[model samples]
Target: MKIAIVGTRGIPNHYGGFEQFADFLSQGLVQKGHDITVYSSKNHPYKESDYNGVKILHKYDPEDKIGTAGQFIYDLLCMADARKRGFDIIYLLGYTSSSVWQRILIKKSIVVTNMDGLEWMRSKYSKQVQRFLKYAEKLATKYSDHLVADSIGIQSYLKKTYNAESFYIPYGSHVFSEPNKEDLIAYGVTAYNYDILIARFEPENNIEMILEAFSKSSTSRKLLLIGNFKHTDFGIRMARLYGEDTRICFLGPIYNQVALNNLRYFSNLYYHGHSVGGTNPSLLEAMGSSSLICYHNNDFNRTIVGNDGFPFDNYNGLKEIIEGKRKEDFFHFLTENIEKIKNIYSWQRIVDRYEDYFLSIIPKS
Candidate 1:
């Protein structure tokens, strides 16, 4: 099958969850002998025409210069280019800017969209933008031949809200071993001596609330926040508010997977505050790396973790967990979570599901 993946900054993933997913999924599909072509930004650091058996096509991406609005242009350009190609399927990772382009989307492909999360629910966007997002979600749903929900919560929401049904396929994870304690020295921290929160600095992620909870936390273990602190207002504000705390360290964005895996593997606890997303990549990675998860209480998070990790309703609840009694059998839960990665959320399993769906939905002539 000839497949084209769109709606991401593109492979080799210098970005977030969707890009990483695209990289892994496209490469994995290629390994299965499928013809895979991924659309990339013109300014993407990697200029290679192919990587890991997948073809790379570049379109004009002025995201850096024009900000959020530029992404619309990029998606439009990708869809325009895609119409000329005879792809069997065009897999869209997200529907943020592409949904409205439904009418213009390539005619040669079956569109399968991954409905990421309830974008309209995020507090960061204005009322106007949220309204558009709600409409966008509907348009995207209307245009897609199939929908993929990364979590049960998302699948339920889609059905309940729009009467849309979606295939449930959660994100994958890479299991890490007992970490190298020496790796902590490079970051000026020690193994098992700190707790970590790795997420984008956004209102939906509850960065400020987490920082506030840590500010009043009685535990001696440091709070290491790994994110692009300067990227958004929430991040900048949180950095300013919590930067003075000797126990809180904002290490900025650390893209090195080895360092990140080691950090999570050795950490005392991992805080996952993403309140909007379904099957967050970081959350899965943390679970796989044996980081005792301290997750925000939500259907999305709870469905994935079950009773395996501690849950928090708010900053106060999170603080209580931090200051309260520790779970005696946490090791067992950590091990179970890694097993969940290997069995359910592995990339191979996800790719298999996608391939099956694509084959099933191919237009019958």
Candidate 2:
């Protein structure tokens, strides 16, 4: 089957979760002998027309110059291009900017949209923008031939809010068996002597709250935050407030997956404070990396981790966990999370699920 994957910055995963999903899913589908074409931003570092047997089509993306509004234009270009591609399936990774142009999508193609986290719930956006995002979400549900929920929480929310049925397909990750202590040397940390938090510096992510918890705690372990914290106002404030702490280090965005995996694998504790988003890729990656995790207590997180990891609702909760007892067996959480990655969230299993779902949904000729 010929497929075109839309909605994401590009392949090779320079940006975030959806790009990573596209990078792995497209390549996996290609290995299965499906004709896969992925739409990329014109500015994506990979300049080639092909990547690991998958076709790459770069479209205009002016997000660098004009800011977030450029995303709408880029999505318009991609959808307009996909309309003429004669693809059997047009898999949209997210419905943020492209849903407004849903009418322009090919009538013959099976449009499967991955309904990302509830955008309206994000604290960064203003009330007006949140209302607009709500409207956009409605349009995506209305026009798409099928919907995919990346977590059970999202699936339930969709059914309750829109009365819509969706396929529950979570994100995927590979188990990291490598623990290169040498990688930790470059970052000035030792094995199990550091804690890490990798996420975008957004208000909803609870970065500030987590930082406060660490500040109030007496743990000697260094706290490494991996994200582009220098670019945003909130992040700058966070840096100004927390930068004075000798234990907290803001290493900025580290795109090297191997380095990240090693960091997570060797860390004493991985803090996942993301309050929104369904089945977050980072959370899954942390689990797969053999790290004991402490997640923000919410349905989106709880549905994925179950009782496998520690849950913290606020700064006080996390503070206690940081300074409190080691009552739970450490190895048990690590092994259970690894088992989850292998059995349920592995890349191969996710690819197979997507392939079968695509085949099942395509109208018979």
Candidate 3:
């Protein structure tokens, strides 16, 4: 099958969730004997090379910032190209301008879009952007042949809000092996005696609350917060507030897989403060790393970790976890369910599910 993937900043996945998902799925599908071509931004720094067996087609965009106008222009170009190229399936990751245009341009294309999260609910966007997203989302669901929800939470949202039936396929984790002594030394950590929280510093992520809770705790364990500090004002403030603290280490963004895996694997516990969105990549990675999970949102976290892990909405509740009162339950949950999570959320399993879904969409000869 000839498949075209639309709606990402392009790959090697240095960015966020959708890029990573596209990279993994395209590579895995290509390996499984499908002809896969991913539509990437021409600005992405990769040569026009075959990743594994998949082809990378770089589409040029006029605008620099990836806001509404820029994405609209990008999608218009992609839609025009996709209509001419004639692929078996066109998979859209986000409900951006590109996705909306693709649906209009390539009516015959078997469109499958993954509604990543409730974008309208996110705190980052303005009222106008949120209204635009709501419209874009409606168009995406109405026109697409299939909708892929990354979590049950998202699946429920789609069904309840849009009355859209979606395929529930969660994101996979890239688990890393234990880091060496040299790797630890490179990060300036004497030992891996710390808790880790890796997320983009945003208002919805509740980074400030987590920092305050961790700072107030008398625990010997340190808190390592990793993310891009230059992306937003929230990140900048977080860097200024926690960067100098001895107990809290703001490691900025570490893109290296080996270093990231080392930090994840060696952590005593993994903290997820994201109150919005479906299943998070960082949380899945932590589960795959066998790290004890502590999360901010009860509804979504409980879906993943059950009652074994700790779920805290406030700083005080988070402090209780740091004080060691909830350590045993979190650890017990990790030990008991880590294997199950590994089996279910592994990339191989996830890719297989995707393959089945893709094959189901293909028409019979």
User: Which segments of model 2 are wrong by more than 4 Å?
Assistant: 325-329
Point out where model 1 deviates above 4 Å.
325-329
Model 3 stretches astray by more than 4 angstroms: 63-68, 325-331
Best by lDDT: 2
Model-by-model lDDT, in order? 0.88, 0.92, 0.79
TM-score of 2: 0.98
Q: What TM-score would each prediction reach against the true structure? A: 0.97, 0.98, 0.93
Clashing pairs in 3: 75-98
* Local distance difference test, candidate 3: 0.79
- Candidate 1 lDDT tens digits, 211-307: 8887898988888999898988878988888899999999999999989999998888888988997999999999889889988889999998889
